[model samples]
Target: MWKADIIESPPGTSYRSVMEEYGYEVGKVIGNGSYGTVYEAYFTKQKVMVAVKIISKKKASDEYLNKFLPREIQVMKVLRHKYLINFYQAIETTTRVYIILELAQGGDILEWIQRYGACSEAQAGKWFSQLTLGIAYLHSKGIVHRDLKLENLLLDKRENVKISDFGFAKMVPSNHSLRSNSPYRQVNCFTHLSQTYCGSFAYACPEILLGLPYNPFLSDTWSMGVILYTLMVAHLPFDDTNLKKLLRETQREVTFPSSITIPQECKNLILHMLRQATKRATILDVVKDPWVIKFQSEQPTHEIRLLEAMCQIPFSATSNRHQSLDYHI
Candidate 1:
C-alpha cells in the first residue's frame, strides 16, 4: 500500500515502466535497510511468492555491481547451510536491481528482541550454535560476512534462524586469508589483532580494536560472542558515541555483570570468544565443547516455547536482572 514513484526511489527509468514490463504485483512492504526496501511481490505469469529487494537506480552502476552484487551472488551461490536464507533469482530493472529471494515469515531477530527482553540461556545456545555452524561453512568457502547484526538475521516459518544480507560481505582469494592494506584496518570492525574483522562495530573483537592483523576464521567467532552476550543480557557489551570509544571499551575487556549466574562453561565460552585473536578458540572447538554439547542436548521445542512467551511480553517490563541478567557492561 505504501507505494512511491519508482523514479524517486531510484532515478532515471520510471518505476511504472518496470511494473508494466515485468508484470509485478506490488504487495505490502516487508522490510527496510540503509540501502533499499524489501517487499512481498508476486510474479503474474509465474504466480510465485517472492521477496523483491529494489536497490536505488542512482547507485546501481556497473561499477557498483562489480564491486558488491557479484561478490554477494558468488558467496550466496556457494552457501548451503540450513541457517542461511536461500537466494532464488536476480533480475535487472531500468532503475533498480531486483534480487528475488526466499521470504521469511517471522521477520528478523531485532523485532523479537524489541518485543521480548531477551531469550533464556538454553534458547540462546541453540541459535548461537546454528549461527556458528553457518559462519564456519562460509569461512570454509573463503567468504566473510562483514555484517552479522541482529537486523540482518531472519527467521523462517519453522522459527529457525537464517543469515541474510551480504552487502558488506567480501570474498578472500583462495590463497589469502587476511588483508594488510585495508584503509579501515585501524577500525576494529575491519581487522582483529591477528585476524580480519569484517563484522559490525558493536560486536568487534578486542584484538580488532587494537589494529592488529587477525585470522579471518576467528573474526566471525568474535562476532558470535558479542551476539551471544546480547541475546542473554538484553544489551550490548560496549556502546559509545563513536567507534573510537566503543573500541577502547572493548579493548579494555568489558563484559556482563556478575549478578547473572550463567553456566560456568557458557561463561568460559564467552570469555574465550572475547579473548585476543591469538588466544581465541576455533569455531569447531567452541561448538564441540562439553558445555555446548550439554546445552545442545536440551530441546529446541522448549526453547521455542520460551521464545514465544518472551516475544509476547513487552520490552518495557522489568527483567529478571537479579537472577538471570547481567546489568554491567
Candidate 2:
C-alpha cells in the first residue's frame, strides 16, 4: 500500500520554496476548503499548468488525516479517464501535504449554472452523459464516489465534464459484481454496505439521510439525480436548510418545475435514479438510458474498454519528491 512520506523542511522554509524545489512555480490561490487551499501553478519540467491542493495537517481531523486522506490518494492514483480529473503526484511535509492534479481550465458546474442559469435539454444531456460515463468508470473499478455534487464536477477547456474531489470516495471489496445478463439492472450484489455518512446534505440520498447502511454505489446515483435535476432547473430539487423537510422531500418523488419544459424521457431517467435506495438506477443503467444516449454521437463501448484497460495498469509515482513510507491505521 502507498503511504504519505513525511519530510522535514529547513527552519523558516516557506511552502513556495518547497514547491519551487519540486520544479513548480506556484501562482495565485484558486480555491479554498476547510483543511487547505488549491493553487494554480506551472510545472517547469512538464511545461504545463497544474492545480496543487495544499492540505494543512494541523487543520484536518485525525479521521481525515489517517483514514480518508490515505484512501483518497489511493483511489485517485489508480483512476485515469477522460472524464475524470487526473492525479499527477503527492508530496508530504511535516506541516502539509501537496497533491498535484490536472488543471481544468473551465470552472465547476455549479459556477457555470450560477452564471448562465439552467441548461437546455441538449446541453444537459451532453453533460449528464459525460458525468454518467465517469461514474460508470469508477463503479467498474469498485470505487464509490460518495460525494457527487455539482461543485465536484468540473469542466476542461473544451467544456467536457471532469469528475473531481475524491475525498469521500472508497473502494468496495472485489467480491461484488454486476450481473452479466442484465448489467443495466440495479445492483444488489454487495452485502457489505457503507455506514459512514459524508457529503453535502443537499446532494445526499434518502438512505444516507435516514442513517441507514446503504449501498455506496446507489447513493452516488441518487446524487447524480440531484445534479441532473439541478441542471434542468437553476437550483436544487430539495431545500437542505431543514433536515426534517429535506429527508421528507428526498423520500418522495422529485418534482419538476412547470415553468421550464423537460423531455418525458429525461424525467423518467431522473425518476428512476432518485427513487428508493433498493430501486435506484445503477451507473450502467444511467449510461444505457435512452435519454442519455441521445446526446452521444457514438456508442460508449470504446470509451468503456479504454477505461477498463487503464485500470489494469499499475500506477507509478512520477515525481522524485514523492517517497513511500509505512502507513498504519
- Best by TM-score, which number? 2
- The regions of model 2 sitting more than 4 angstroms off are 1-12, 176-190, 302-329
Best by lDDT: 2
TM-score, per-candidate, Cα-based: 0.73, 0.86
Question: Number of clashing residue pairs in every model?
Answer: 12, 0
Give the alpha-carbon lDDT of every model.
0.63, 0.81
Error of 1 at 62 (Å): 7.5
Q: Candidate 1 has what TM-score?
A: 0.73
Question: Residue 172 CA error for candidate 2 (Å)?
Answer: 0.6
Tens digits of per-residue lDDT for model 1, 159-179: 778999977566664322223
Task: lDDT for model 2, please.
Answer: 0.81
RMSD of each: 12.7, 9.8
Model 2: weakest 10-residue lDDT segment is: 318-327
Q: What is the lDDT of residue 55 in candidate 2?
A: 93
